[model samples]
Target: MHHTTPPNTQLPFAQACENNQAPILAVLQTALQSSRHVLEIGSGTGQHSVYFAPRLPQLTWQTSDLTDNHPGIQAWHAAQTAPNLRAPLEFDLATSAWPTPADQPGFDAVFTSNTCHIVAWPLVQRMFELVGTHLPASGVFAIYGPFNYGGRFTSDSNQAFDAWLRQRDARSGLRDFEAVVALAKLHGMQLQRDEAMPANNRTLVFRKSLSQ
Candidate 1:
């Protein structure tokens, strides 16, 4: 997908999003090929939505974030005119209500990035709970962020990052991969891939059981 820069005035921009969007799309190109609709959690600047929606034309992208991030997301959404992409919705994992429709099947895929380590641990758990509750059977859930494996930091950089996170908020820090997997399992999803992304981040793909 060719991503154009938003005019300097309106929306916010995250270099990290610009840096990582290509790699994330490389994976989602295949992972989300069959998906018709996707719910993006924590769409920081809506850069990913505009960048991805045009490329993956088959899927309708639904953007969501807390109320505070709406203007930037909306601005980005307005700047781009991908019919497949929806406007930003005010949805927070911990506070806002889930936008589930009783008559329709849930999202075909759920995507979130750089959120787990930022929110409190309980919110992460709650996020998974919402994923399990709203994702359709066999639906994909992709989460991208730095994560520890076997309760050990993957790199010294990640170690320092963790320390910085704790210093900022004692309740927030990188999550252990194993613990996260176990939590996903309890919620009826199974890990399908733990992709090593650029920098120290990972994009974990989990799929719900079709029988569930």
Candidate 2:
């Protein structure tokens, strides 16, 4: 059945996405060599999934987000002809139980881009907890967004963006890199790679620790 479009306007399709997709894929190509099922959280305009799914045909891309965002995601999904791209699912990481059924083996990898800063800190922590629960011990979780390192903004633009975000919503702002890493550790995840992306953003890759 056809889905209605979401209310949010089309994002600018950031040049950063264009510039970084290849590099990000290069890393994923190696990191996800054995991974087949990938769950993408908070797929805003669905550009990354559309771009990556066709390139990695062996990997099934399952995109998800809050129900309100499903329509836009469907619109983007409709444009993709890749057989590996699945329909967008309704998911909210803050919730205790995932919307997906338990029978489904957890995702081989969980990916998200440009979302952490938009949500609150507790939600971010909860997201890691959910990721830890849904992913296998050796599975990967990758997040891409602007972030502050050592409690300082990495760039002036990011600082301005942080201010803008806070002005819009007091709790919305760029997160601290160290804090995220520490939280991930608490959930039995280890920081694997922290790559600097174009436009002052970063891609942080974490692996769920097998030791529990």
Candidate 3:
């Protein structure tokens, strides 16, 4: 999830994905205990979908990302296919029209890692907007990445990372946790957990309001 590789890699890989998948899975096993289906946004190289689907055998894992990332994802899927893991869907938060509730009503949980800091802010808002619209009452949404708190970085490493990200794209940098929670609130979601992750990262979990 740190970088997007070219499609022609035949078998794209990300060490960060490998290092973090286990810890992420441990958190997910509990967070998504009752979830029967999950929609994975930004499936980068598809490493997470493959790793998570087989382990969380109770749920069907739906992978999605921009079309350019599909070949790498498909290649990974071909190498380690899971019956519960569906193929990747072409999804772009900035441009793709999200599936209607009738078309994707069964997705009870959503997951995305290392995406918020890379995409522009408006797209990030779109992601929460679509998730808020599509997710049913009590649906679970989990996002993993470095986030700022109270308008400040959590650690020097995160500060440096944010600098690096901004250097690459002026619009892309770590987001404020408060702003994220506020956005989620607008979408009828409430924060359920804020877990500390390795390498100065965090995993935030939100639950859609039942009143929705």
Q: How well is each residue in 25-135 modelled by candidate 3, as lDDT tens digits?
A: 988999999998899999998899999999999998999999999988898999998998888888899898864334444788999999999999999999999999988
lDDT (0 to 1) per candidate:
0.87, 0.81, 0.90
Model 2 per-residue lDDT tens digits across residues 57-169: 87888888788777766766776668888777877767736546454556879888877898888888888888887788799988888889889998899999999999998
Q: Which ten residues in a row have the lowest lDDT in candidate 2?
A: 1-10
Runs in model 3 with CA error above 4 Å?
1-9, 100-105
Candidate 2 off by > 4 Å: 1-16, 101-104
Arrange candidates, best TM-score first.
3, 1, 2
- Can you give the TM-score per candidate against the true fold? 0.92, 0.88, 0.93
Best by TM-score: 3
TM-score of 1: 0.92
Count of backbone clashes for each model? 0, 0, 0
RMSD of each: 3.5, 4.3, 2.6
| Candidate 1: segments with Cα more than 4 A from true spot | 1-7, 101-105
